[model samples]
Target: MGTDVDIALLVKELCHHDAETEWIEFKTNNSDAEMIGQRISALANSACRLGIPTAYMVWGVDDKTHDVIGSSFRYRLEKRGNEELENWLHHQLTDNASFEFAEDVVCEKHVTVLMVQAAFCHTVDFERVPYIRVGSYTKKLREYPVIESEVWSRITKSDFESIAAKGGLTLPDALSLLDFPKYFDLLGAPMPQSRDEVAHYLCDDEIILRQDDGRYAVTNLGAILLAKNLKDFPTVARKALRLVQYKGRGRSEILRSKDYEGGYAVEFESAVEMIMALTPSKEDIIGAVRVQTTAYPERAIREILANALIHQDLTVTGSGPVVEVFSDRVDFTNPGTSLVDLMRLVDNPPRSRNQKLASLMRRFRFCEELGTGWDRIISSCEALYLPAPKAVEYEGAGGSVRISLLAYVPYRSMSLRDRVMACYWHACICFTNGETMTNKSLRCRFGEGGPSSSTVSKLLATAVGDGLIKPVDPETAPRYMRYVPAWA
Candidate 1:
């Protein structure tokens, strides 16, 4: 169940939807328990087929006009053979299927919303019979043989990365199609002397599976991670990384572009090199010397690329990971949204859609441990006094995750809000380390040199005035004043 305001906004959004989608249904005061259970099953199954995360069954909205006339139905009060409606529904569903109903009043109308978790790795069934949503109608799974077959196929087709891109290849063909030498090198293992030995090694890693016909097939994992040319495998060629550099901030003027076309393990180093080459660098002046550094940290860029490769939704076709360089920033994008919350990305253990790919990447040292990549990225930027990288979700036909690394914008050119946010994040990082933000620390964070205590004090005053941070100890001496995040 969601908050009252959330439910109201959801209901309103559903009402404005053109028509009932397969993943959503509307009912007007209908309290038929049996019918509701069946609808739930149908919607849940349809959601899985449609690749949606959740399905919805809303009451109190007109199916035609989408008007909220209110619902008289109360699911909690409904009973079935001495059992509560929700309990009975839970018992009827297979695979431990679960759902919740949220009740709220919107525009003086009572509305009830049922949120159903999609059937994952299995089809949802009630009363031992699976149901499916066909357009606006709910029908028994047996009646729709094609959908039933498709649903079963979807449920059983687990581990998309492990699926074979092509089957029935001879040993020589398999070896030729993959960069076998690099694979062994990455693993620090001696390359097998014979073709058969290498084939067995690939089979052991599940990179290639022996076919029933006695030939071998390259799995999607093998092709994506070790293929000689990703383009050779038609199924995953679109997943290759694309790098584009624009003359300016927009896409209108293209400076240069390149599509990396090898397996991730093979192309990762070259890709990083190319990205670093295209990234502009700045000159740092020391007491009597000049030092050059890339605008963005190489480690951060590498981690972001590794993340794009490992965490992307390989199920999403046509779209691939892209790196776009603009005059002021570079955006690294990958197909699909992150499985973990964006706010928790830095500290939380990473959640990946392609665990095997991630595992192999980690094994190859392409990325850090499972959960530490974001922390490194954040720390790298913080150490360089660069603005924190911005992670955003681009939603459309299919969603994407993008992280942008901004060019080194001068502190004097930053907006008030930007300065405040930077200060807040600095305080957050310091607090996490069991310390407090002081003028000295803030100056060091901003990489300001030559004793600018007053400047940093003014920055802290601005943040405090904006209520983003507060003094850790009001009684502390002004010379040793420290601050912390407002929430802290």
Candidate 2:
């Protein structure tokens, strides 16, 4: 059905759902501007607090009387200098909250629908304060213990750019640690000759904001995009890339660990190249000549790195990006959650928690078109004949988001390229010597359990035929025989 039918049906059909409360309500005559605004805030904040993805307020419907009376208000009408309604509301809001107004014609009656998407956070606070309504009344959201805590957590910004540094940092002190040259280069703007002019430029661009005192303070934007050391910026420093190489499988037996940090504009390309170096490499046979190849696909590496950089929560304190190399699949996870729906991540456009952060980072070429990052990653995986990447959003108990990507193994009937991957993973699994390669294990590893033992054997046999895998035992051996990664 259309939006009109869907909108009405939601109130009727979904009304019976367990979590469904009075998420949808109506009002007619009491349309004072500020009061209406407050009601909007109350409903929006309440919807988020109540855990509903969205809430609606319709005009021309008697809220208490439940009578349908068309509203005369013209929601589409705008005044001078108020062209962007959403932007205007966002500017007024202490936090970013998304809402839409639609005038639907139901039985020739016009209804103004004010719909709000629940904050990815706990509460939608206005001016940094969560306000709620109770029994036809409104009050401080903090009046309720549970709801209050959630609101504080949700509305609070964890991004260093949003968070003020301890005591206040001096401009030069912050600049001393970062590479200023990288900033100007990324902007393609001519650098002012004077050092003080550069500081003012950074500050004016919101890269740095000086304190009330004579000294200057670098914004999180400054620290991340231009920091000499991200570590100095406590909120986001840990977000620097971290790599852990294991001798066998899990990260328990780590051989090396390093944090990737530098100017977001200057450091990303180098960081990605360095991390790729730490991963496995292969020798490709091209026209009778064997050429070395990166064990993990470069696109896969870049895609994950960009995902890490762009989608991270930046709110969770001390959390950063981590890449754990396993004998089988490589795991890369960054702190933060996808702003878009989990299932829709690959297909949908990107949504960011910190839009400003996203905007500045985009200037540095750190991300592809918003919402297209996951698609690129998937395409990259398929191009290499690797299984489609397993992308996921992890919700920690404390309410943080972490995105993960698992490298795919190659097998025959999958891809000639995947066959190469299967060899590497199978051999790598065998190299562990503890877990055996079996049909179930292979299925579980690939997230597909439909294939039987015979099919798995053929697939493994194909890998062995290519000398990509050397099974540790006979074909009849149980799932205990471990295969080493072909590199070993």
Best by TM-score: 1
Worst 10 residues of 1 by lDDT: 1-10
The digit string of per-residue lDDT tens for model 1 on 360-406 reads 88888898665878777877888778877888987874689999887
Segments of candidate 1 deviating more than 4 angstroms: 1-157, 282-291, 449-488
Candidate 2: segments with Cα more than 4 A from true spot: 1-160, 166-170, 261-263, 288-290, 399-408, 412-488
What is candidate 1's local distance difference test score?
Answer: 0.80
> Per-residue CA lDDT of candidate 2, range 364-431, in tens?
66665556666556545544545655556666632444434445453434555554454345434333
How well does candidate 1 score on lDDT at residue 392?
90
lDDT top scorer:
1
| TM-scores of all candidate predictions against the true structure | 0.65, 0.52
- lDDT (C-alpha, whole model) for all candidates: 0.80, 0.58
lDDT score for residue 166 of model 2: 20
Q: Which residue pairs clash within candidate 1? A: none
As a whole number from 0 to 100, the lDDT of residue 237 in candidate 2 is: 62
